[model samples]
Target: MTAHGLVIGKFYPLHAGHLGLVRFAASESAALTVIVLGTVFESGSHERRADWLRAELAAAGAELGHVEVLAVRCDAPEEYGTEIAWVANVAIMRAALAAAGRPAPTAVFSSEPYGVELAARFGAEHRAYDVAREGHPISGTAIRADLAGRWSEVAPAARLDLATRVIVTGAESTGTTTLTTALVDHYRANGFAAMPVVPEYGRDFTYELHAETEERLGREVAMDDLVWLPEHFARIAERQNELEDAAAMACPLVIADTDAFATELWERRYLGATSDETHRFGTDRLPPRDVYLVTDHVGVPFFQDGWRDGEHIRADMNGWFVDELTRRDASWVLLRGAPEERLRYAVRLIDALWARNATFASPPWRSSPPSVE
Candidate 1:
């Protein structure tokens, strides 16, 4: 007879400690049934936690049949501690497992003393590990207290909220791309293996559209040509943020080339107007990043990239970027001076941020949107 193992929790923002329990269960049992019981009070989404578990378990060294993640929603686990309430909780877990074709677990694995009682409910053996938490030395409660301070404690698949995004924004001819690449290389070389470069979607989309026009009509199109259209901008801005969000989920530290806010400034340059639809789509529709480093067009060589509108447009756009960022009271750092100097400054800023976060004990995440500054 095989010991079918079971582990249950919110895995609420599953941390390293939870991983330890999962690893232990997988090793001891023939099959490990992970039941993620989520209430309305959990920090992360139930779906996200479930998805994170699936990704992790699939990657973990376990037989295909030995590990499984199941999401089962129930009453708030904290709302009651009565004996009957636990009986009810056990009933819900048992029903869901049975419905999914899992045998009542032969062993219940947990770090809490309640495991003894929980196992008794099913007449299963109580197997507890790390009840003292001496190895991992961290808890989900500690994570809730300081998400930034404990970012690495967050599991890989559930790490989007902990992501630190550094956006490089500037007008044409500026060193945005160069600085973005440098920063990405720096972050990756040190650690942060999943660092991503979210390139400007507007440019890519417009470039493709421009190319198609030239091929079809035999007349070349440019960036300014499409700026007057609100629909094009709105589409670009919305998708731009989506790309950032997706990248952040993987990296936990993203280096963006440009963002939707830059798209708005670009639109203002060519259309001689701003799009209300674009503004909201950029600001309201997406998760905001923590830092925006604006590169200066001056002290850098200017060259037309087949799509650029030259020095005059570049100058005007630079002013617009600064003016708008100020008017909106958005957080941003202006990078000037030599290329090497600029890169060093950016590196120092991020380096210092992480250094501070290393000791930071306050929570970085909240129920609402977080700011850059």
Candidate 2:
């Protein structure tokens, strides 16, 4: 007979341990339902945890099609492992399963001792794994205490949501790519194997579009011959954001040559001014940037890459970046002087950004204070 398994947890910030347990459950049953229990006081949202599990399952080739992720909220004041908490928690879990049109689970999988009671309440068998956390040797509590230090414990998808996104943006030929690569190298050289650098998608898009247009006309076309449209920029901006987001999820730190937010300025530069639609597609949809490392054009010579407009516009674009980043109250640093000096300052800024973002929000519950005399 086939068995349906159930696993429940807050997964306040889903970690590798949770993934291992879920995988174990999937192995023991034909189908598995993982409930992400959440409370308002938790730092991370329940829905986001569900999304992470789904992404993880998709990536786990063996368990891809059999696992289901669901979200349920429980704010019962009763402490876990108590009779009252069991009764309350079980009821909520049942209601959630019913609302999702799922049947009572045949087996319950967990890393906690309460799995026995939880399974008993649902007339299911308890299959516990790693009650002592010997395998993963990690917990949400420990991870919360030092999220940055314990980053490897976080699930891949959750890492993206919590990672610091640093965008290197400035005018054309201002060494944005150079600085981005340097940052990635700095981190990877120090043992961060997962550091991903997202290249500027807009540049590729522009090149491809120009090539196609030239092909249709059966003639070589100058960059100036290309036409600009709001929709074109909108597509570029959306794709840029997509690239950055994918990189963020893959690693703890994302260094992008340019990003959707910077696309807005490019739109203005090419089209005289940004259209409302361009902003909506680009800057308006930006994920929270930890910081932007802007390359200054003051001392840097602009190289006329075939696609570049000209050297004259470099200073203008640099100024626009500063003004716009300031208007949005965004954290940014201007990188000037030699390439090595620029990289040193960029590293310092990124280290600071990592330190700041590494701090996690404390969970709501607090330990009891010493009794007063």
Best by TM-score: 2
Q: For residues 126-239, what per-residue lDDT tens digits would candidate 2 score against the true structure? A: 888887779988887777776656777888778777888888999888888888888889888865677776989888889998999899899999998898898888898888
Model 2, position 92: C-alpha lDDT score: 90
- On a 0 to 1 TM-score scale, where does candidate 1 land against the true structure? 0.60
C-alpha lDDT values of all predictions: 0.75, 0.80
Q: Write the per-residue lDDT of candidate 1 for residues 1-373, one digit (tens) a residue.
A: 3479988877766788888888888889898888887655444456667887787777664454478788887652331347765777789889989989999989988887678878898889988888888978877767766665466677876675556777899888789988998888888888776666688888788777787777877876665654247778888888888888778766667788888888777667666666998888667765656778999988888988777778777777778788878887877898988888999999988877655533323222222211000
Q: List the residue pairs that clash in candidate 1.
A: none
Q: What lDDT score is found at residue 370 in candidate 1? A: 12
Candidate with the greatest lDDT versus the true structure? 2
